[model samples]
Target: MTYSASMAVQRLFPTDEGHDLLDLTREVVAKELRPKVDAAEAAAALGEEFPTDIFRILGRAGLLSLPHPEEFGGGGQPYEVYLQVVEEIASAWMSVAVGVSVHSLTAFPVTTFGSPAQREALLPGMLSGHQLGAYGLSEPLAGSDVAAMTTRATRDGAGDDGAGDDGATDDPAYRIRGRKAWISHAGHADYYTTFARTSDARGRGISCFIVPGDAPGLSFGAPEKKMGLHCDTVREVIYEDVPVDAARRIGDEGQGMPIALAALDAGRLGIAAAATGLAQSALDVAVAYAKEREQFGRAIASNQGLAFLIADLEAAVLGARAAYLFAARLKDAGRPYGKEAAVAKLLATDAAMRVTTDAIQVLGGAGYTQDFPVERYFREAKVTQIFEGTNQIQRLVISRHALG
Candidate 1:
């Protein structure tokens, strides 16, 4: 699991701190992540246990807050620099990379739209990495179409839900009741960044909140049985009359979709970077195996066909890395990058799938078995195509941008 990071990827940082940040990331990954990746993933596959300690390790290194404002416990790194760090983490251990991405995703609403007081109160804890966050958006009935979500957050006042007598003394709160499916860190998160409908108006009716994990009536379904990323947990987040303080709401009512979309645009880049890293890891394995494994009097890597396949896979990995970085750069510049983000997610994830599959092909029988990591890579690659808006949805986003 000695992963040589991409040397060909050209990174231009506006500050020397950016370079130092990446160096810190690599040192942490090599020291803390790579050594235990396989065993952790294997345990996770059977036990459904998430590596909370690893996330804390990342948080302690200031890895979790790289892109936010330093005033709010962030590292103040740009998206371009932050994403490269993510790519490096994913190259070593994808589950931790994904965990970091999802945690960052959950913090977006508070970072971007929360009140000054809310930011002062919440951002420090969330960005610290000691407290993980979960996003509650997609339900079983509503996946890609977030507007179709049925989760409702009702304003609980002195009259209703039994908050009595001293009306003037009580702070405002809302009772959220709903189920969120496919939520990462569902049971374990310290907070849930939830989107729930506050009115009957389709997409515009929704609102966002930071619901405390230990709140009364907050619960989670059992962890999902998944294909890969076992060290990351996915489960249904359930809220039954969960009372969240009004101060916890991130944005104004009816502004949830925009906040969600903004976070999603950045999140798409994260997935793209992570997927590219996975591809890089798979390609590395394929190359190392090809060099050592022999057939018919010499190394199988000597065969022109196998060598060509390896070369093509390397090219694809590099392309996937470039695609995500391009989108990350646009975001770093404060440019409109929704379309580019979609394009990166589509291309990079698809490339991961293809490259991992081809890696398996090159490894032949050994790749198909658990003895080599290629099979696990193949399993993991499939989900990247499905989540963060499927590749098909990415094409739709790209097409709309193209049309306009």
Candidate 2:
């Protein structure tokens, strides 16, 4: 598992395609995202509407559609390339990174399993960034245990369930009733890739659906007040006897759980890349500060203690980059990448937490202030470990896969 320094550097530094993506992404961030980060944060803190308009701008830049088909107006980039783009964007602002990651996660099911009609109909707006999409698998009762979801979709063919005698009217052939909690883009997304119970079977009953945000009987609760990623809205989606036609169902019954898990496998890689980028940003800040600030009539960075610390952070960032790149390559090859993805997530997130903390230590009192980006980077790093399945769950996945 020895990593080549040249390859790692190449991946991080870039070539023509990479440079083009990075330049385009940085310009968008500089022109649009960076100036608005504070404004977006303040707005979210005050219970105001998030700037959904920014997503449309990003979509116009091709940032939102990197991994999708070119026929759908996506970038058609490989996972390795896509993750690198994610890292660079995240290094600038964690919330935008989260939005990009969530949208990418939402696109997974549709791209992988949606019917031709569904893909053709749904992806144009979504990939174009006109409509924001969210994944809705989590419930009040099910977070880690997706099988425990209680949202039910009882199939009623026209007359039996209660729609009407005339089945031709397009009433919800099935009524949806349940609440999904911790849904990213809960209130803002135009559509949600949701899951529900279609039967009494444990895992077999689960089914995925394309639930529109404006669907009848669908409403959002207040957004959750969280410590970080404030710009990204997370809340509960209540479906109270909502009508949905059979056509809206994502896949055949019992396919939802696997769809959710596979989407997670892809999403975790995005989180890992973002974590690596965040850590890299923190390290850059620490190193620049250490070199400029003088103590004892000498640059603090010249001191062995500070030098060693910065070096360690650099090493960790490189390692994290390598780990995610390996996982991304596996995914691009259409190979089994679950265990590798879990390892990448665990290592990259842990590295981000450690590196961001040390970055604060490097800056002394300055790092603790709102003026420094490291504090925000530190706060943002925490959720990377918690979401996309907790780091503890990642360990379990790695160990279970190893034993198997």
Candidate 3:
């Protein structure tokens, strides 16, 4: 079953424009993404290959900037609407959907915490759909414990004229020196939203900076060999004495922890939505195969035992979708949704893992082969429980909120 047929899942939009945007997204998925995803993913798994053209196509279609403010080249769509678009994309291509989520996370600091001047100068390009971004928060030693990060950004000498190596003038620059690990689009992004320590105040010492991709001393390591979502391109981003103008900093010094946490809340929702889509696709394939595959001169779907399993998969996919949509609605209404986001991420990703695994079982011997997509879906679903904070971290967030 192709993604287009999987659109049988009913959806509700807050506005006519939202409905149209989804229609556009599905059309693009059918025409552009689904056609190329298998070939592209296979090529990427063998060597270095990033879907630069596909991103450009999405950018030009205005899909990349849907959640940002309209005043600065964004579509100004609500979180609920933007997330559905992400889910639709994920149904067709999981790697591209994850890329969209990571790109949105990279812009979260500037959109949510940047000063007026920063927004005016940077947002147009960032949200213009012409640029891609990477989030630089995790490090080799500090994946979950963000405060343990050793990346340092020191203020330049007082006597020096605040001039960048590129001859751009911005007073009071800072030199960043560190490495970020497990970064998506590490070598291909137009800019990196990076966090580094500036003081000795533990969590209060860090700050955020937007470093241009062309910045001197910014380099990337070879991509990590991963089990799935190979086209997403995970890598290490090395910042060796990279200079950034203070003007590029999103929030004030000592505010990075809050900024990063807030961004994760939103990022978690993205992951949840994507996971739901993936599960839906898996369920769709399983159902289609069950109806066609035969046993004892009858379709296997006629067997009550197999049919019950299909029903459970359907229930899990719908439950996951409801979980994320509820969280998205909370975020759209300007309410505190951190705990809900964590819950959604935990539920949806766990559902994805279960649904995809069952989908493979539904196909039996055929599923274990590359001839069917369930094997690939199983591989992709495993990582959803790991990234955007592990399901373990989600439980911690939910417990803290409940206790408080």
Quick one: best lDDT, which candidate? 3
The alpha-carbon deviation from the true structure for residue 322 of candidate 1, after best TM-score superposition, in angstroms, is 1.3
Q: What is each predicted model's overall lDDT from 0 to 1?
A: 0.86, 0.82, 0.90
Q: How accurate is candidate 2 locally (lDDT)?
A: 0.82
TM-score of 1: 0.94
Q: Candidate 3: deviation at residue 99, Å?
A: 0.3
**Can you write out model 2's per-residue Cα lDDT over 142-180, one digit (the tens) per residue?**
888888889988776662232122122355667789999
For model 3, residues 246-290, the per-residue Cα lDDT tens digits are: 777778788999999999999999999999889989998999999
**lDDT, model 1, position 317:** 82
Which residue pairs show backbone clashes in model 1? none
Top TM-score prediction, candidate number:
3
Per-residue lDDT over 127-209 for candidate 1, one digit per residue giving the tens place of the 0 to 100 score: 88689998888999999988899999998874222122211225446889989999998898999999999998866899888
Q: How far out, in Å, is residue 366 in model 1?
A: 1.1
TM-score of each: 0.94, 0.92, 0.97
Clashes of each: 0, 0, 0
